[model samples]
Target: MRCGTRWARSNHFRSLPQRPDSMSIVLTPQELRSHLERFPRVSLGYYPTPLDHWTQLEKHLNRKGRFYAKREDLSGLAFGGNKVRQLEFLLGDALAVGADVIVHGAAVQSNYCRTLAAASRKLGLDCHLVLSRAYDQPEDQGNFLLDRIAGVSIELIDEPLGAEQEARKRRATERLAAAGRRPYLITYPQSEILGTASFVGAAVEIFDQFQGLPSVPRYVATAAVGATQAGLLLGLRLLGWKGHVLGFSPLNGGEYAIQEAIWSGIRAVAQLLDIEPSLEPNDVHNLADYAGDGYAKVSTAAVDAIKLLAQTEGVFLDPVYTGKAMAGLLDYFQKQKIPPEEDVIFVHTGGNTALFAYHREVLSLL
Candidate 1:
């Protein structure tokens, strides 16, 4: 019935040894009361999603590390994905500040955009999206299809004019204000980190889940982005998760660029939680070696990894984010960089629907 602890009742973990040392890291109701006040958020997900062993996948990895998955993808809103967790807090903040509408910018296939649309609908707020030409959807599939189905208003910004997109969204907000709509921009530098808080809450959930387990993970790998990775790292520090929070960037940016985003998100966490300013930039770990050809463009290994997982585990991972991250994880396992018997949890950030677009490439791999 509790957040992270709810998984304790699942049949998956029932057969495993009940190590007396195994413990859960969720916050007490009292602690949550204090922790939540520092951050503003919306209620958009079912927190403490199940943590289950990927025994099938783990065994295949053939590494010493134990493999586990924190199913944030099952967060229980808008067809489930990790973004729902962040939206719960991010949108909650927007509403608390009297925002009647929310706007964001991302690629057309952005899970964030789709999930935000769903969050806006649930909270009775209008939603607007600005995306680059590459994200433009002529037919609608994956997140794009879902966005249309959700009835989210759209503005397609051709080319790479980042400033123009921001200005347009801002102008849209102004127009809404003129129309007596208390629109919330949910723009970057503010809403970005607010969305990250949910992930920090997630980190706390992870800490609780691992507390009872006798063995500890040496590394926890997950896809990186502006928010998900940030929240995970912050939560690790907050709860003192004694493991390497490995962020495998799906995009092509290098360590410093990725670290900058993570640092900003970390600052947001510190400010929201009144946490000590003790975190250092060096504390963050980026797995840059795995980003093959850069963001969104499928790499050879990424294609292979997707096929391997589908055939072996029957778990479909999206080509853009989760699939690529899993590619890195599998690579590490094969290379023997991750030691055997060490506990490792991969955060499955959900985007399987996106795979259909790359059907030809994916089909070739199988």
Candidate 2:
């Protein structure tokens, strides 16, 4: 949140204000692509998702600058979400090590679970999911249903998402290995770090898409858990762009934990790309206030955001991730944290399938 004298608010780039010398350096899209090619990748989703200029939403808000949503939501996969991007590199790592089975875990209606299952099937690999019972409803709808359709092995645990649940996933991976199956645990940090490369590639793609002024967003925001956000920041850094990367934490609390995750992601990703990390902890902003009551619990504001986008732009955002992020974007706009004069982008890290699971809550808001 400490982006000082941004070009967005200052005369619309007709005259730009002074920034640190680090901001002066810029890299070409091809340079970033070369660095990204060093890592192996699986083509599970479409590359360079569209940068949509939501003029209808902009008209509704009556903002002067350009308003865009980088549609990672429309990633061409089983259901399409940002997880498709991460899984490309993550699954590639699995194949590189000859992994025949992929083991992962998260909440019951996780976008990651659905995407991974679909990708695993695509690559002819077995998939197993150790899911936490984080929801109060039947798991017969939304992403869980999709998982069932994928025919992946499923273990629904009574625990919530935390270290204990992570341990459960590791144990499951070990059990798979004992059965003489080659397994890759995507829950591990090493595998998770590879996901960063996908988003870093995303930043490079978005940067190239933004070739003109006013169309270029000064603020790039997303629902992040550090690694994804860090990769985007690294992409911007390598390109010598100091655009504000606003991260809305889907998890409601734990400020320190969020900061640690993001900083570690920055460090880990830089190491992966063989560059000294140029991003500091302070540079990262994990805004968790918009996370309603807790993780997976949709807030009133988030529902409003979901409704607004759907009604105006015909874009549907899932209750858990992108909806809350859109809420934060509006909150920032209201508070002038992201002023009206500067362009802004909300990175739609998709999860609309969860809408069916949270139908009652979403309907109440309407």
- Give the best candidate by lDDT: 2
**Candidate 1 vs. truth: CA RMSD?**
9.5
Q: Least accurate stretch of 10 residues (summed lDDT) in model 2?
A: 1-10
| Candidate 2 per-residue C-alpha lDDT over 1-366 given as tens digits, one digit per residue, 9 for 90 to 100 | 111111111222223332233232356889778767766679998878998889999999988878888899888998798889998987876786678998888888888899999999999999989998866744989999999999999999988877888888778878888888888777546544677778889999888888854556778999987667878888888787877899998886762387777777677666545565456779888888998887888789999999999999999998889899899889888888877899988899988998998999899998
- Report backbone clashes per prediction: 21, 0
- lDDT for every model? 0.71, 0.80
For candidate 2, the clash count comes to 0
Q: How close is candidate 1 to the true structure, as a TM-score?
A: 0.86
lDDT of 1 by residue, 85-113 (tens): 87776676666566777777777777788
**C-alpha TM-scores of all predictions:** 0.86, 0.90
Which sections of candidate 2 miss by over 4 Å? 1-26, 212-215
